[model samples]
Target: MLRTVSYHPVVRALAAHGLHTTVDVSRTYPQRRFTDERDRQYAIAAVRALFGDPAGREENGRFHCLHYESRPESR
Candidate 1:
């Protein structure tokens, strides 16, 4: 399951106090469509809404796991 720390500053700060911060929005378990950009956005937004922005955190930022991509034949 793809996981990461919560985005909320408060939540993240409180994590040391025995709070749960790991979010599991893996497409495989939830049966989500990773192919659709909208779906991917939704998943990311959901994380932000539930937690908060982790961009301010050190060594942390948004990322995507695109194993491969296809280019147009003409290109």
Candidate 2:
């Protein structure tokens, strides 16, 4: 069985800083109310293609997932 994973708020906070969010992976890592299977898969593939290793996990009442980091100077 899959164990529940913790959601690191810092991860979401950082993703937000760059206009990105963990929600981007709904397809590959489906959870209640977050997204449907199709979207999740699309998101997963999209992320993998872009970031090489996209994060996908669950915690609390929500699902946490991978996010890309912005360049130092971009922020």
Given candidate 1, what's the lDDT at residue 31?
A: 30
lDDT of 1: 0.40
- Residue-by-residue lDDT tens digits, candidate 1, 27-60: 2222323556665565567556656342422113
TM-score of 2: 0.29
Q: Which pairs in model 2 have colliding backbones?
A: 26-40, 27-39, 27-40, 27-41, 28-40, 28-41, 55-66
Query: Candidate 1 — which residues are off by over 4 angstroms?
Result: 1-33, 52-75
**Steric clash count of candidate 2:** 7
lDDT of 2 by residue, 22-56 (tens): 33343433345436666556545554454434353
What residue runs in model 2 are displaced by over 4 Å at the alpha carbon? 1-33, 57-75
Error of 1 at 31 (Å): 8.2
Q: Relative to the unseen true structure, what is the Cα RMSD of model 2?
A: 11.2
- Per-prediction count of colliding residue pairs? 3, 7
